[model samples]
Target: MSKLILVLNCGSSSLKGAVLNTENSEVLLSCLGEKLGLPDAYITFKVDGQKEKVDLSAQPDHTGAVGAMLDKLKAMGLDSQVGAIGHRVVSGGELYSDSVLINDDVIAAIEKCIPLAPLHNPANLLGIRAAQNIFEGLPNVAVFDTAFHQTMPEHAYTYAVPRKLYRDLGLRRYGFHGTSYRFVSEEAARFLGKDVHNLRLVVAHLGNGASVAAIKNGQSVDTSMGITPLEGLVMGTRAGDIDASVYEFLADNLNLSVKEITNLLNKQSGLLGISELSSDCRTIEEESLNGHAGAILALEIFSYRLAKYVASMAVAAGGIDALVFTGGIGENSDIIRTKVLNYCEFLGMNVDAEANLAARFGNAGIITTADSKVVSVVIPTNEELMIAQDTARLSGL
Candidate 1:
C-alpha cells in the first residue's frame, strides 16, 4: 500500500484536508473547505504548492465538500495513491488512548463522545461518513486529540468535586492539543540530542485556543485544561480558570441563565472581554505597545498566567530540563516569550534576547543563554502531520 495518508480536521463549518507522505514528511496536497451549509460556501485547494479557490453553490455541506475535493484529486491523478483517511477527533473522553482503525463500533464510541465535544465531534462524524462515501474502498483511521494525554494518572486529572460526579458523569480533566504536544516534545528532545524517555519538559501550546502540559520521561503527567477546552489558559475569547460560582453569581446579578453565562465566558470574555478591543493577540500586542491601558493589562495577565502555569507544571516535569514553546503565539511572539521567561527566574531560565528574537517565524532555535539552568526552545507545531503518521501506523499502510 502507498504511504499517503489523507488527514482531515472537520470543524462545524470548515474542513481541512492534507495528503502527507509519512516516509519523507512531505505534504503532497492540501485544501480547506469553509462556510459549508451557507450560501457563500467555498473550498480552496493547494496541489504542488499552488492554491486555487473554488466557490460553491448555495447550501453546500460536508458531503458536497468532500466530493469536490475528491474531484480535484481525481483530476490530478492523486486519488488512487491515497492509502487511508485520517480524522482529527476531539474529546475521546477516556474511550480511546491512541489512534484506532475506524469501524462501526469505533463510530458508535465517537458518537457517545459527542456530548463531551458537542461543538466538534458531530462535524467530525459528518466528515467521517462523507469520506466513507467519497473515498470508498480506502481504509479510515481516527486520531483523537485526547490520546496523548491518556497517560495522565488519576491524581493529575481528578477534580475536587463529589465522587458521584466523577464516577457517574465522568467529569474530569481531559486536556486537548495532545497531538501538538506529542509532536513538539519529541522534536524538542531530538533538537536537544536527548532521548525523549530521559527528558523532563513543560510545554506551552499557546494559540487562540491554548493549554499547557507537563511531560515527564516523555509522558503527560498533568495538564491545565480540564473536562473542556474552556477550563484553562486565557484564550482569545475563553475566560479560562474561572470560579464555578461565577455562573450562579452572573445568573443572579445579570439575570442570565446558566447557558447564557457559559456562552458569555466562552465567547465574550478572555482578552477581548478584559480589553474590550479584539481577540487577536497580535492586535492586543500592538495596542499595548501603543500604551493602551486595557491592552497592556491584557498582555500582562496573559504573560503572567503563562509564567505561573509553567512554574506549576515544572513540578510535574520533576524539575525542568527545558521549556518548549509551540503554536501561533508561542512560536512567533518574541515579545510574549520574553515576558513569560523573564518571570521564570526562579526556574533558572535566562532568556537571551537576541536568540529569542531570532526564533520567530518558522525558525526553531534555543531562546535562552547556554548557561541558563533550563533551556528554552521554540518549535512550530505540525498537528496534521502527526495525525497522518498515526493514521498510517494504525491503518497498516
Candidate 2:
C-alpha cells in the first residue's frame, strides 16, 4: 500500500483532518468536523474533488470525531495506508523548537504549557491522545505553531517588563501562525524565483486571527504576535496592542474583574467592538459602502494598524525585498489590500489596481507594478501540507 500521512488540526469545537501521499504531498482526502459535542455536529469530507457531508445523529466529541474520520478513510481502504499522524499543537513553550515525535514525555510537556495556551493546548492534546488511541504503534508528530518563531532573537522576543518574570516564567513573545508564515515565506520566495536564504520578506497573515512577521534570510526575525495570540494586529474580535492602563481603567469604571477584562479584549473587542456589528470583514465592507460610520471607522483602524505593523516588520528585517499577503482576508479582500497598500506607498510599494483585483479566488499572483521596489503578492497558505511534509520526514515515511 502507498504510504500516506494524516494531519490533524483540532480546536475546542472543531477538528480538521487531511490525508496526503507521503511521497508527493498530494492530498488524498480532507475533512472537517464542526460543532462537535453539539446537536448540529457534522463532518464534511472531500475526496478527488467531490465533497460529502455526514451529520451525526448524536453529538460526538473529539474521540468520536476522529473515529468517524478514520472510519471513513478505512471504508475507502486508506486506513492501512496512513503511516503517520501529524498534529498541529498551538503552543510548545520553550522546550520544543521544532516538530518532534509525540510520546508520553511530549504529551506531559504539552500539558505543562497549558497556562501558556489555555484555550488551544488542551484541545490539541485531546486530538493527539485520540489519534494515538485509534492508530496504535503509528508514529505521531507534533507540529507547533510557535516553533518557527523560536528563531527570534532575545531582544525581539523579550518584553520590557522585569527580568525575573521572564527568567522564572516564560513571559516572553512567542508568535503564532508560524506554520502559515513558514509555508508562505517559502512560497513567496519560489514565486519570486529567488532563494529564500538571500531574501528579506515581510509576511502579513490577515484572517480572523491576523499577524505580521519579518523573515530575514528565510528565518523569522520578529513577529507581531506576542506570548499570546491576542497581542499584535487587531483581529476579528481581539483588541491587539491596547494601552496597558486600560485594564485598570476598565476595572475601576466598569467594575469588571481581570477575567472579565481579558474576555472583553479577547472576544468583544477589535472590529466587532469598534463597529458594534459583525466581525466578518465582508459584512463590514458592505456596511462601509452603505455609509455605516462605525464600519468605516473599523476598517480604517484595521488597515492602518496593519500597515503600521508591516512597516515595523520591515524595520526588523532591516529592509524588505518582498511583501507577501496570505490568509483569508489577505488572500481575498481586495478592498482591504488596496487600503493597506495605499498607506504603505511611502515604502515604494505600488499596487497595480487591476492585478490587485485579479488576485482572488485562490490565485497566487503579484499585485505590484513591475518597477515597484517592493514585490507584493498574494499566496494562499496550506498549513496542512506543511504539517504533512514535516510528519513524513520526521516519521521516516
Candidate 3:
C-alpha cells in the first residue's frame, strides 16, 4: 500500500479532505462533507476517478463526518496507509510561525486564537480534535493559513489603534491565505528562473476571501489583510478597507450591535451586497455582460480596488519583478484580470489579452508582453498540496 498524507480543511459548515501520495504529492482520493450538522448534510467522495455521494439523514457533525470518511478509506484498504494528517488551521496568532506537530499545548493555543478567527479557528480546532481521535497514533501537523505572514515587520502589521489593544488582546494583523501565498510565490520564483530568496514579487490571491501580499526576498514584507481577513481588498462577501467611522455610524443610525455590524460586513457585503445578486464572481461577470447595473458596479469596484492594492504592494516591495494572480477569480476570470491590468498600465505592466484569456482552467503561464517591465502570470494555488508536503516533512515521511 502507498503511504498517503491526509489533508483536511474544515470550514464553518463543511469539511474537505484529500489523500495524497506522500512521495510525489499526487491526490489519491478526495471527499467533501457539506452542510455538516444539518439534516440535509451529505458526503461526496471521489476515488479511482469515480465519484459517489451519500446523504446523512441524521446530520453528522465534524466528528461523525470524519468517521464516515475514515470508513470509506478503510474499506478501500487505505486506512493504515495514512502516514500523517495535515489540518489547515486558519490562525496561529503569533503562537506558531510554521507548521508544527499537534499536541495538547497546540490545541490550547489554537483555542486561544478563536477570538482572532471566530468563524474559522473553532471549525479548524474541531477538525483537528476529530482527526486526533480517529487517527490516534499517526502524526498530526497543523499548517496555518496565517503562518507565512508572521515574517511581516512590526510596522506592516501594526494598526494605528491603542497599543494596549494589541499588547493585551493580541489584536494585530494576522493575514490569511498564507499557505496559498507561500506556494504561488515559490512557484512564481521557479517560473521566473530566479532564486526565491533573490526575487521580489507581489501576489494577489483573489477568491471568496481575497488579499494581496508584498513578498520581498522570499518573505512577506507586507500584506493588505490586517488583524482579520476583513481588512483587505474587496472580497466575495466582505466589505474590505472600509472607514472605521462606518461602524460608529451603523451603531448610531442603524442601531446595529457590534456583532450584527460584523456579520453584515463579513457575510452580506462585498460583491453580494453591491451586486445585490450573488457573491460568486462568475455570476456577477455574466450579469455585467448582460448589462446589469449592479453587477457592473460590483465588478468595477472589485477590479479597481484590487488594482490599487497590487500597486501598493509593488511599492511595499520597493519594485516588483513579477505580479502573480491566483485563487478562484484570479486564476480564471479573464474579464477581471483585464480590468485590473488596465489600471496597472501606469506601472509598466501590460497584459496580453489573448494570453490572459488562454490561461484559464488550471493552465498557468505568462499573461504579459515579453518586453513588459513587470512579468504578469497566473498560477493556480494548491494549498492542499502545500499542506501535504509540509505534513510529510514534519512527520519525517
Judged by lDDT, which candidate is best?
2
Show how many residue pairs clash in every candidate, following the order shown: 0, 0, 1
RMSD of every prediction: 1.3, 1.4, 1.1
How much does candidate 2 score in TM-score? 0.97
lDDT of 2 by residue, 175-241 (tens): 9999999999999999889999999999999999999999999899999999899999999999999
- Listed in order, each prediction's TM-score against the native is 0.97, 0.97, 0.98
Candidate 2: worst-modelled 10 consecutive residues by lDDT: 56-65
In order of TM-score, best first, we have 3, 1, 2
Give model 3's TM-score versus the native structure: 0.98
Per-residue alpha-carbon lDDT of candidate 3 for residues 337-394, written as tens digits (9 for 90 to 100): 9998899998888899899999999999899998788889999999999999999899
Provide the lowest-lDDT 10-residue window in model 1: 54-63
Report the C-alpha displacement of residue 146, candidate 2, in angstroms.
0.6
RMSD of 3: 1.1
Q: lDDT for each of the candidates?
A: 0.91, 0.93, 0.92
